[model samples]
Target: MNDPSPAAWLRPMLAVHRRALAAGCAAVLARTAAGLSLPYLVKVGIDEGVVPGDPDALSWAVLGCAAVIAVQAAAARIETLALARVAQRMLHAVRSRLFAHLQRLSLDFHERERVGGVVARITGDVASMQPLVAEALVNLVTSLVTMAGVAVVLVVLDWRLALAVLAVAPFLAVLVAWFRRRSATAWRRVREASAAASAEARESVAAVAVLQAFRREEVTLGRLAGRYGEERVANRRPIDLASMFFPAVEFGGAAATAIALAVGGHRVIDGALEIGTLAAFLIYLRLLFDPVFQLSELFDSVQSGTAGAARVAGVLAQRPSVQDPPAPVPLPAAGAELRMSGVRFAYPRADGEPGPEALRGVDLVVPAGHTLALVGATGAGKSTIAKLLTRCYDPDAGQITLGGVDLRATSEDELRRAVAYVPQEPFLFAGTVLDNLLLGKPGHDRARAEAALAAIGAEPAFRRLDGGLDTPVGERGEQLAMGERQLLAFARLWIDAPGVLVLDEATGHLDEESEERVQEALRRLRRGRTVVVIAHRLTTVTEADQVAVIDGGRVAQADPPAELLAAGGPFAVLHDRWLRSAAAG
Candidate 1:
């Protein structure tokens, strides 16, 4: 598919900064007029000053040219400054909007997109437009105006010579059209190839530890080399096109200059053209090509900017699938019940088709201040349940609500304040432990953060850190052990202790000592709140108010722990196996 024009989005941005754009444009015209006048002054010095032996007039002409140069420099500086400020402001808005929109986009968008591809839209793609905005824009205006000014001067100097020089205009126009279409296609492929390569690099780096542990470094390098080679192949097409285009334009300009020089030389000899005018024609012939030549550079900017803008625009065009109602419904007070009724959902495929249903008419609930542990085999939809509860991915054909408020109706801010979901692996932003802790509740101080950690019985573990509560967690809390990271997450939970909390297999794979610590923390933390716990290990759900056995995307049985054990069904078999496995661990 042909990419949408960057002008679709860029025009409005340019319009918003119309005043600055006007200023820059004014400077462009002024600079062009001043610079173009110099050749006229040189012509006059020869015709009216030197030919008549008027030294005073020649000195005046020289001084006039110098004055015009100084003015041109000033106007050029103003144009550069004005456009620079405008570009910075425009890109700042684009980057911020891109980032904010990415955040607002539904989870499925992210699931289908590579991390590096998404990041490049904001970083690399956005940065590519800088030249188009700052330098190329200025060059575009300067070249066009200089050529137009030169065209008028040449016509006045001698229409006969101007007509001869103008013969190449039609050919140049056709060449420009060809280059624009071909280069745009070539550069677009380059952009896509670059983004793919970036994604490969980032994925490799993120999984480097896994690659090493599995002794797959050489294979990983081979894959990376393959992607780099793909990028090289993509890039070569544009380089080849440029190689053909630059020389073609240069030859056309040289031919036009040669013809203009020959024609003007004859006119001057016949006294049909003045010596000064012939000299001006020679200067202007070169000047005319300056802008013609600039078209090639301008095409690069236009193509690159167009490619980047299209990607950025595509992201911005996405409307969030999950959004608050026109008038948001406020969540009820703390300890509201959480409910899912006939929740049916299927994950979307990257190919634009929907996958088979993961949850089929599933219905479940947790009363206020109650703990419901969900026990299920892998792929039985336990994690899917947690995600739906938190509104990460809304059910395709059902409703999930908290305190009688539909999740879709509740504003994101209020819902976030009311519900908390802790996954098997929680992502921790790069910061001190205290900073992560402070993310718990607004108005929470350092002492309060420490207290929240203590409330979950994980304070002592963190207090032993080199910086204690102030220690850096590194990226995603990698500086800490698994249990330590779990404890920090629980501590953040302890701060708000929202009305609804969802925990997904938190202690499934921790070391014995770390599991014990996490278990202890979980025990202290599941107090006076509606909690939905997803666990494969039966041992973790012993203290849950009720245990619900999930099988084949439906709740097969649910009862108090002791009651379910006595029933001797699937839960009983799972409990027996879990007991042996827990002991083995």
Candidate 2:
């Protein structure tokens, strides 16, 4: 709930995007200065040309003022274009940093935060910053310049009148400061409410079918309505306050104008001031009001953007829990050999509840080009072992080694190239069939991809498509069945050819026939690669050269499946239950 400091990020926008920043500033400054010339032109026209009854001079001055106005208009257009380019460049940098940081963040972070919230921050939140950079920033400087220029001209016209106008300045300053503080908080609430709504809506839509099937349509609707209602309430309060803001300022500015007229009119009537000079003073007074009016109207946008900027900076400020090593361990020439010695891990639990350990001093090793199957019931540290092997979360106590080198010393890029993991629920991006596959190996050609697809029995499915590799996959691969998605994920994994492969319930969704096909594909992929399979099906683990039974965060048994079955231990009970269940089904 703490807001990020704007200076934490925006200050660096200048250093990083120097050329764009410079161009934006130059354009805005030139335009603002040109705009400042308009009041001076009016003063000249009134005093020197219009007052003299000189028709030719009056015509020439009027035309000159028109020309200045046109130039100011052209400068304003150029400045807008320049500011837009600068804003886009800054947005690109912010998005790039967020993406790169996301890749480096630990799995624990992802588990703790909702996908909808993160997506909203990156897409919706960053987009809110456009007005800040493009309009608010440029106008802030321009308003300052115009205010200063008008004040100087007023003082030159008459010190007493200038001092009178300046009397209301303190009140304006107080109002700006007060509004900025209050409006910033209001805008922050608006953004938070928006993110909350986005997260709830995203979750609801993703589980729409479940909600309908469970007959919870009214419940879901009520929840959504509650969220939207909060958003509406939060939104209206600020708008209501902001609506009163301009009207108040206009009333105050008008009162100041009346006072100026009353005081200045007496000086003119008493022959103490020229008619032309008084006219010039009136024009200068209007010019003074222009900046104040602009400041009043734009405060809401400026404050809102300031709040959004703080949110963006806060997201950027998060330090990735997992980072690359300063000096990376070189890739082993003979491929990967994974070892875990005395590893332990525990998930932080609540104060009143028991803090359960997930992994406890577990030691295991998998030789190069071998398959290790971990068989256990739910919450038996099976998935935790897989996570540790990949260094997704470093063991609290012991060493994880790849090719006899400590994994903590390995560079992230090197580790990623050496290891590939397919989770229980595989995700597919929205793109063509080839696009998802290419993510596995960015530079891989179509021939290589097709070979991988063929290995996984996916080539026939690909051929059945209207455009083969060009066919689009719906969001999260909703277009394909679960088993088909798993097969496609294997095809992708095969193209990468990483030194180590970790499969977490890869065949969970497959029926007997589909499981056989995918098992065959997995077997083909296993050769010459280190494979770690977290298995639920007894039949699959029975095929591994070695199987380890995990119980209570420790390895209960480690041997070949046949040997473990013959011994009649924990694995025997699990295998029995799995077989009985399969028979029943």
Candidate 3:
């Protein structure tokens, strides 16, 4: 009931290409007119030229038929070209808009939705509209016009034979209406099933490493086969319906033609109708049935296309959960102080149900040029604090300020430039090392990137590679070791030189040597910048100027590491456990 109509989704796209669509429509109409003129020309030639023994009339009629064929061919070519241009332009616009919108959407949206489903909507669903836009829409118009022209000519030639043809019209209409209702639901299932299969395929490919490691290749294959089977069943339903519908339409056409022939033959014998007129009536019936059958076939394509359009429209209708302020405040100069006041937050459940709070009313501050390490068990909101600092998710009931300005009020560009966050798992795109590094600060050349790598002591890893900066990172940086990826992340941070840095266990994946190197790089990078570390390693905690121990979505302790240990609080207990673990190792 809440579903959008096909026109609702298609209207905006059509409006954008209205001029081209209008031209295509004109061409289709011209082509239909030329086609309709041929039967009439045959009638004229038979009555005035062939029977009357006039060679000039017959020659002129033959020439007219030739001209009509030529015009029809030219008009059809122009119509196809014009409609194709409109369809391709619409596809480009829709795809670009969908991709850009996905980027603008909040991380919350991304977290809730499957990446494969989103990709399918962008690629498969959008592409499915091709038939509707390029062919079905235009062809449908042409069929209706041709049918109308044939009907008029049929009646004009012999009213009684036209009556016989009109007799089957109601039955054909009923058949089409029945097919439309059934096919819409069937095609919708097909689209849903296809999307599911696409999502499964993407997930399986992306996690092939895990599958192979667990030796579950057969299991995954079976799962994929099941998904594909569902898709096949969904696809078959509409096709089966169309197969039956087409034959029924053919039967109606045959019945009408038979009636026209038998009735018109009797009339001609009685001298009530001219032989040429009876012949034209039979030709007109064929013309009428041809378009009617074509329309029925086009209906199937339209149904499928509408199903795809509906899915695409649903995605485009979502407004971003996060948006820029109407009037943003200016960031202060020479101030890198970061503070959180009474911050409380919760991540919304994907199913729109209530979920546990990720963070509770908490307060913390770090000086303009100091470090604060957040230490806690997993899910104790350590990473949530870092996320809030980076403005990935705003707090439910608190204000986070950077440089004495509320983060929500600050411009996105300025805020991002001032605050940089590096997560535990660093991601590299499928490109050269230089390309990944340049993403840190746009317009910086290879020299600057090399300098940044050298500054972080990451140059040695790249030097071992054949092409250094030009070496491909492979998909998601799978080519490099985890340590190498983290080092590159540090090099990126150095290039950007932000006023504040938030690292959520940035060295978690590194070995001892890599960890030490990264820590040394961090020490240099922390100078004159507000640093917030979501500490996973004890070494990182010991080096922080202040430690914040979080428990149950709230900060239980906030003090220097030495002071907190002496106090024998939650931080003391955690530090003791960490020390014991290290000594045992």
Q: Write the per-residue lDDT of candidate 3 for residues 443-507, one digit (tens) a residue.
A: 99999999998887778878998988898999999888888888888888888888888988878
C-alpha displacement of 355 in model 3, angstroms? Answer: 1.7
lDDT of 2 by residue, 489-561 (tens): 8898878778888889778877787787777777777888888899988767987879999998999998888
Candidate 2 Cα misplacement greater than 4 A, ranges: 1-3, 16-24, 49-52, 333-335, 348-356, 456-467
How many clashing residue pairs, candidate 3? 0
Error of 2 at 88 (Å): 2.6
Rank by TM-score, descending?
1, 3, 2
Pairs that collide in candidate 3 are: none
Candidate 1, residues 1-585: lDDT per residue as tens digits? 134667777888879998998999999999989988888898999988998899998999999999999998999888988999999999998899789999999888898789998998899889988877777778888898898889998898788888988999999899889998999888888888888889999999999999999999999899989989998998898889889999999999989988977887887788888898878778878888888787786787778877888878888887776787789889976877888899899987877677999898888878898999999788888888888888888899989988888899888888888888888987888998888887866587888898888898987898788999889999999998989999999998888767778888788768879989998898888877889999766667787898888888888888888998998898888899988886896
Which regions of candidate 3 fall more than 4 Å away from where they truly are? Answer: 1-9, 333-335
Please report, in order, the local distance difference test score of every candidate based on alpha carbons: 0.86, 0.80, 0.86
**Which stretches in model 1 have alpha-carbon errors above 4 Å?**
1-3, 440-443
Number of clashes in model 2? 0
